[model samples]
Target: MGFCVESARVMLIIFNFIFWLSGVALLGVGIWFLADKNIVSYLEVVNHNVPNAYINYAAYILIAFGALIFLIGFLGCCGAIRRSKCLIGFYLFFLVIIFAGELAAGIIVAIYRTEIEHSVDKELSNSIKMEYTFANESAITKSWDTVQVELKCCGGKGPDDYMNSKFTNMSGIIIPISCCVLSDTNNMVAKDKSQCMNKVPEYYHEEGCKKKLIEWVKSHSVILIGVGCGLAGLQIIGFIFGICLCRSFKYEEK
Candidate 1:
């Protein structure tokens, strides 16, 4: 039992580090996205659009993951410090809980990405049809329903329309700007004609879009600090406790 506990401590430390590093990297990426003006530029490099909503949501989740690691690490450290079998068992159980949370989060994100991908496909189709008739006035101003023809079309209006919808729903504070749309220039299929000429100026200066982007940044920041700081603190405390637990083991043997 002594050797087994010792070995578990060592393994736990290794796994804890792995979790911490991953959490940090994700947090950093989220911060960069929030600070940068042209998020699309960074996202383009990664072959993603980095939707405002996803960024906000993912940042919070990453923080939570980090906190879990920290808590488990701290608990393991405490168990080692006191050489308490009860604490050690508890630590292990908490680690399992963290693992389950990670798995669930992964599944949630996967489903979200799949849905978003489908939406993108639908958006691409609409963009293509719109592109073929670009110069035509009738073709230029597509209706809200016309935009919704794409699959997985959610509660939002258009792509930009979705932006407004997100703004309205974000944190229960609605900042309404009726005429907005998300550009499809980033679409994989109709990449060239993704930018609707009419929507370019609006993209840069639209109040609704700007407000939504700002809100995205704010909400994501809360998520990052809440999760990241909490996790880091937990890990440090856990490590200290683990050392004490380890010493206790030798004391008990003597």
Candidate 2:
């Protein structure tokens, strides 16, 4: 085989191997997200009574997307191995579609992050003061508690924000135990119940859960963008190899 055909075949096969690994990683993450208690808590907030709930059922979406990627990688590998032009064409077509979709998603996220944050923060604040109640066993209550404890944060803005919530007026407590520096973070048991409940600054988390979440998202934005760029480059290279291989077929035939 000439350099073009041989090189293209090898490169495409390698690409498929890497793609398969990525699919497996995605699948694992999806499974982990579904099984994890913290992630389950996040689901409650994600499904808040809001239109365009973007991340609702996110674990399922990740699983489905991972499976599709796995299937495509398998098919692409087969095409490269067997030198099937038709299969290669189909592979390229689907890859292009995925590339476009992901690119658009990245663009949308970049353009809307600041603008969307305002509405999200507003909704979270409303949830804190208006919807939240202590020991209610409701989904919103549970989600807020989880966010407070797990994120090591207090209310939407801070512990004082609870004063406006039904949690304080009805329950007659200054702060939720979940806002405390918990002895058991997972179970929401406070390290010092008396001090924490009395609104002692030392025993409580000073930061706001909403603010912490926003910071976490911002901190990881660069990594997410880098990974996205890397994946796009991988797809682009695979597309190029497929094209070169197709041209080689005609070249060899001639």
Candidate 3:
């Protein structure tokens, strides 16, 4: 019996350390996502178009929850090491709250996944039509160019999506050079000089950016869901260990 209690206490201590490290990682990711200049600028331009804009809110929540988790992990570690019933109880309370928050977030994402995709697609299309231009580059324009260049994609729906664009009409260019496939030897020169002026389908990416972007979002959302489930499972184990430790400590006192 004594051996079992000792083993449980050791496990609790190790779990708390891992939990603390996870909290730190989460905090760092949240900060990076919110503070990155390019991401911030892009989001600012589309903020009004995005529905509810809860993605930013989610980042804020992550930062706050990460801090709370770090504090709870510290308390849990001390509680396990010192066999303090009060601290262990407090840690359990906070763990339960974190679990509840994770559950709520998961539900919200599941419920509104379709609406979110629609909002993203619509805003992307609108941004491309209204704001995209190679000349007089703005943040939105830069963002689109970066996406096109990196993703090897054209306009939101297709190259023709830019048909109604003011830039296309004024400049008489069917697609930006960013959408073109430059040769290995002269990639930089071609991109810089707009050498791939040919608007033919053979010269540019055939697929659309909107579909690719949506697919990317969906893939990441799956990963996020998996991470959330893993965290919730960890919280459940932590709760069990906490209760066991608290009980063992009480039994010794009596």
Candidate 4:
């Protein structure tokens, strides 16, 4: 029985070490996602024009949860190494709370999936109509230009979506340079940027930003879902290990 308890303690310590490492990795990824200048640059467009706060909320939640997980994992590791029942018990309690909170969040998202999708589309369209401009001076303007250049897409719905835009009347330019596409040979030349000025269908991407964005999201949805499930599974395994460690400590005390 003593040997078994000792073995469990060793295993628990190993488990906690792995959990702590994972938490650190998660925290790093969250920070990278939030703080990367390029990513944040694109987010300026969303932040300025979109009314939807969910994206920012989600990012903040990820950072907070990752930090919590890191702290909890550290505590669990120490508790396991010392065979301290109080610390292990506290770890178990916190683990359960985190698990429940995640489960609740999943449920809420599932319930509102349709509404969320519609809201995102509506907000994106509104933002495009109200905020997008040809001038690339502001963060939001630069972000939209970046999106158009990177994605090779025009307005939210299409080039026609910009017909009534303030940019058209203000600049007397029908389309922005970012919307123009050059041939492979001329693509690198600076002067090619002005070549698409009056050239409509011949030089511009036909696909709308909204459709392209939605397609991009759809393509990655599976990966995101898999990652979420994997995290939940990890939490469940942590809970199990924590409980077993706490029980082993109790057995040893007796």
Candidate 5:
């Protein structure tokens, strides 16, 4: 049995509403994440923590979600235009696929939360220790300053003067440094201009920062897992409802 014109029209409208809402939401989320403060510093400070992984994963997920939303919306629009329940059903099928993907990813994240937490903690603890140690050492501070000054003065000739140089020695090349590490003066100057050097060599050499980082990751794992599971469940409900709505339409036709 086919849908009565009025019922089909109403269903089509509802589908459009869902499509629009989902599409706009996805797009907004993607944009927000791209501009989010945490993501901006992702390359700088993200260690092995769940939060860091979440942030990175979330950014890409938002982008993927946005694209999926656009595709679903377009398919929904086409289904409406054709007045074909099969097409609409196909759309719902894809929705189910998306829901399944969410469920799987959420489960994986939850299952491995412990390992991720431990790794993150270690890296973070080490970073903190390096930072604190460097701060306490007066000699290291002076050397770093001298290096900075020299890097600035060398007419940008040294490695520090290179295009991606984060730290430069006096009249030498610039070196690249990681956000977690501080710039060092141990090497008088870098010979290679192309290589980007990490600034916090001492942080890598220490282990204290890693412990604190693990502590933080363990504390926050629950929230991330909860949200992931919640979103998956919600999507499944929506998918089931779509199927029921289809069935209802058929009954009305008979």
Candidate 6:
């Protein structure tokens, strides 16, 4: 039993409505993530088929979490209207689950991020050496070419990274043409493929994909933490309202 049923009921409804909207925002963001040009392409590369595993999991997590939060918010609103203690209980249960999940995900990411990056680096280098066939043009080859051209980066490191790859090492080339400065990137027209391949300073990008990708990941971490904190604050609000409404319903009955 608790105090102020009437006020609690009204406030609970208002808060749940806001909660519902947050879910929608999450859903929208998740969909937007999937629609991002290069990000979507990166998401498709999972397990052994592709690298960038961190982002691959995040995409699914966002969509699924968004849907879950949407349902909880809807249930919270309904519970407040009917004064259903069971529904309120269910709402609190799920909110706790979500909180725990977010915490766990954060901890896991913090511990494993560097390890994951190293693993991906190894796999990417392996792909560049063996899987990215220059003659046959495997998926990895095209993907690497696209990454190099679009990101304006060279190999996993710099152009010299290709020195160990079969195609470049055997062919005695320093870098792929994709590394070259391009007048028309869409057409894959390098301004100086020969010079780029020969490691000319003017003809190619010096930065490595590994460094570029790490920076990209770091940039998104702040956004993720912001979103997580926002959701966490909302869930705390929900917990308060849920308890107030549940106990107040009992008090009114008594």
Per-residue lDDT over 1-254 for candidate 1, one digit per residue giving the tens place of the 0 to 100 score: 66655665665566556656655665565566555544532222112333434544554566566555566656665665555767776875675565555445445444544455444444433432232122223331232223222211222223343333333344232211113243442331222222322445433223222223233334544544455445445544544445545555656577
Native-vs-model 6 lDDT?
0.71
TM-score, every prediction: 0.40, 0.86, 0.84, 0.83, 0.50, 0.84
List per-prediction Cα lDDT, in the order shown: 0.44, 0.72, 0.71, 0.64, 0.46, 0.71
TM-score of 3: 0.84
Q: Return the lDDT, model 1, position 202.
A: 32
Tell me the spans in candidate 3 whose CA falls farther than 4 Å from its real position.
31-48, 183-195
Q: Give the TM-score of candidate 6.
A: 0.84
Output the better candidate (5/6) by TM-score. Answer: 6
- For residue 240, model 1's alpha carbon misses the true position, in angstroms, by 21
Superposition TM-score, candidate 4 onto the true structure: 0.83
lDDT of 2: 0.72
Summed backbone clashes in each candidate are: 17, 0, 0, 0, 27, 0
Predicted structure with the largest lDDT when compared to the true one: 2
Worst 10 residues of 6 by lDDT: 43-52
Q: Write the residue-wise lDDT of candidate 6 on 94-189 in tens digits.
A: 999988766655554454356556566776566667765566356666777777887788777666667778877566666777888898988889
Instruction: List residue ranges in candidate 4 displaced over 4 A.
Output: 41-49, 104-113, 120-122, 182-195, 200-202, 218-225
User: Alpha carbon lDDT of residue 174, candidate 2?
Assistant: 80
At residue 100, what lDDT does model 1 achieve?
58
- Which residue pairs collide, candidate 4? none
Give, for candidate 2, the lowest lDDT window spanning 10 residues. 52-61
Ranking by TM-score: 2, 3, 6, 4, 5, 1
In candidate 2, how many Å is residue 140 off? Answer: 1.5
Instruction: Say what the RMSD of model 2 is.
Output: 2.6
lDDT of 5 by residue, 71-110 (tens): 7757765765665678778878887776665555555545
What is the TM-score of candidate 2?
A: 0.86
